[model samples]
Target: MKILVTGGAGFIASHIVDAYIQAGHEVTVLDNLVTGKKENINPKAVFYHLDIQDAQVVDIFAKHRFDLVNHHAAQMDVRRSVEDPVYDARNNVLGMLNILQACVKTGVQRFIFASSGGAVYGEQVTFPADERHQTQPYSPYGITKLVGEKYLFFYALTYQLGYTILRYANVYGPRQNPHGEAGVVAIFCRRLLDGQQPIIFGNGEQTRDFVYVKDVVTANVKALDRKDNEILNIGTSTETTINEVYEHLNALIGAGMAQKHGPAKEGEQFRSVIDYGYAKKVLDWQPQYDLQTGLKETVAYFQ
Candidate 1:
């Protein structure tokens, strides 16, 4: 199968490309390298430095006949979205529409999207948020993701386009940028390695469901085989607090690091967790790596 992965040079998409290539599929990566790194692109896969919003993107679709399109490109930072919503919306909402337009025009069969479980559900009082949970996005980033899913649903129902929306939890692992708003794990790991104290917004007790990138890759690969066209939550279904995460990383780094408290950022959620029962039943997928194992691997990579 010929697969096209948008933002293929990114942390999560790079890993997805790895899985696709290992499965003996022909992969083409379409990325502008804006937030994505060139070093992350797999040598085996064909690369095109193109933004998802470019008009020329449609031309590429007319040229290459892609069987699957894994859409991962977006303005992912919640804080940035809050600050410059129009800018963020143009990139994520309009950008996704451009890709979907190409997909429809090119007759692409399957689309696998990287949706955010973190922001889409907002601050769920519940521990495990399922697909059936109420979607009231607190941030523009989350709103755009939800809007993309709605568009995807419409495309599927109207145009017969098959898609799998994977709502991912807080994912961390190798190649993750510590600079991004969502890369708390990577940021904490790097800080701990440097013997710097990590800062936590509000209380250090803010909890999030952490899923490993490798496990995310597994879910992506499995989506290739499944014919389902539903939104699935990809997570461990366990909440880990910010302070606990710090301790875990500190332990891995062989040190104890205290966290500094700061004012909570706008559109920030206090607690988030995703229920994976639907994913397990539908995709026959479950998380394979725990925080300890994944942290050890991620720490080694940073070291």
Candidate 2:
């Protein structure tokens, strides 16, 4: 399969690019390098240094004649989205539209979208949200992600374009950027490695479902096998508190740093978890890496 993976130079998509190449798929990567690192790009895949909003994207699509698009690029920072919504919408909404235009114009068959199970659901009323959970996003980042999903629905309905929307939990693992992707595991590991104190915001009781990147890759590979045209939550149906996460990382790093507390960011979700039963049924996807196992690897990477 000839596939175009947007944000293929970023943490998660870069790994996806590697797996796709290893599976012998003709893979092309498109990344602007704003948050994505060039080093993260798979050497075996073709690379393009372009943002998703660029007009030349259509030209690339036309040239590659891609069979599918795995859309992962976005303005993904929640706090930043809160600070500047127009910037967020420009990339997440407008940029997404540009990619969709390219796909529809070139007659690409399937689109595998990377949505947020946590963000889109906002403060989840359900302890562990399922695909059927309500979507009342608390932030601009979440809103834009939801907007993209809605557009995907529209595109699917209007153009008969197939799509798989994978709403991911809080993913953490190797190649994750502490600044942008903002995996708490990565942040803790980096801070500990740098001999700095890792601060836990608020009382540190906030809980999130932390899924591993390798598990996410499996879901993406599975998504390529069919066009189910459904939104599936890719998560563990489990929740871990931020304090617990910090303690685990401290143990993994063997750092004796004291727990540092800070004021919580405004508009932060208190608790978030999502169920993957739907993904299990449709994509046969379930998380394989537990927190401890994933944290060990992440700490090693940072070390």
Candidate 3:
């Protein structure tokens, strides 16, 4: 199958691009380099340096005539989204429309979306929120993510465009950037490597579900063959506290730096975890790497 992976230069999507190319699929990578690095892109795939919001994307889509689009490009920062909602909307909403419209015009067979499970289901009432949980997002970033899912639903109904929405947990692995729209895992690893203390927001009891990037890539590979228009949560259903994450990384890196406390930023969720049982049933996927193994690999990358 011909696949076009947006944000393919970024951490998670780059790995997906590699896997697709390894599977002997004709792959195209599209990234603006805002948060993506050129070095991360696989040379085997065609690379296009363009934002997803650009009108030029239509031409590229038409030229490639891609069979599927794995949409990962977005304004992913929650704090920035809260500060400038219009900017976030332009990228996450309008940019998405541009891609969706192109898919319809070019007759793309399927679309795989990378949605945020923690962002959409903010401050979960249950321990691990599933696909059926309420979507009461706290930040504009989360709101826009929810909006993207709704747009996919609309496209599926009106245009008969097949879509698979994979609501992701906190994905971390090698090639993850340490700055700009980065997760706590990357930031912590960077700080430890640099011999600096990593700040713990609030009391450091806040939890997140950190899924390995390779595991998430497997789910994407599985989604290609699934024809059902479905939304699946891609997570380990295991919640780990911020403090525990720091401790694990510090142990792995042998960084003797102490943890420093700071005031929590706005638009931060207190607790988030998602159940991927539905994903296992539908896509035959489950996370293979646990936290310790993932952190060890991440530390090696930084070293």
Error of 2 at 76 (Å): 0.5
RMSD of each: 1.1, 0.9, 0.9
Mind sharing the TM-score for model 3?
Answer: 0.98
TM-score for each candidate, following the candidate numbering: 0.97, 0.98, 0.98
lDDT of 1 by residue, 1-303 (tens): 999999999999999999999999999999999889999999999999998999999888888889989999888888889999998899889999999999999999899999999989987967799988899999899999999999999999988889999999999999999877679989988888888878888887878899999999999999997546889999999999988888888888986666688887755788898999999998999999988899899999998
lDDT of 2 by residue, 1-303 (tens): 999999999989999999999899999999999999999998888999998999999999999999999999998889899989999999999999999999999999999999999899989887788988899999999999999999999999999889999999998889998754357888888998888998888999999999999999999998998886999999899999999999998888889888999999788999999999988987888999998998888888888
Superior candidate under lDDT, 1 versus 2: 2
Model 1: colliding residue pairs: none
Per-residue alpha-carbon lDDT of candidate 3 for residues 105-125, written as tens digits (9 for 90 to 100): 999989999999989998899
Worst lDDT 10-window in candidate 3? 175-184
Evaluated against the true structure, the overall lDDT of model 2 is: 0.92
* Every candidate's lDDT: 0.90, 0.92, 0.92
Off by over 4 Å in 1: none
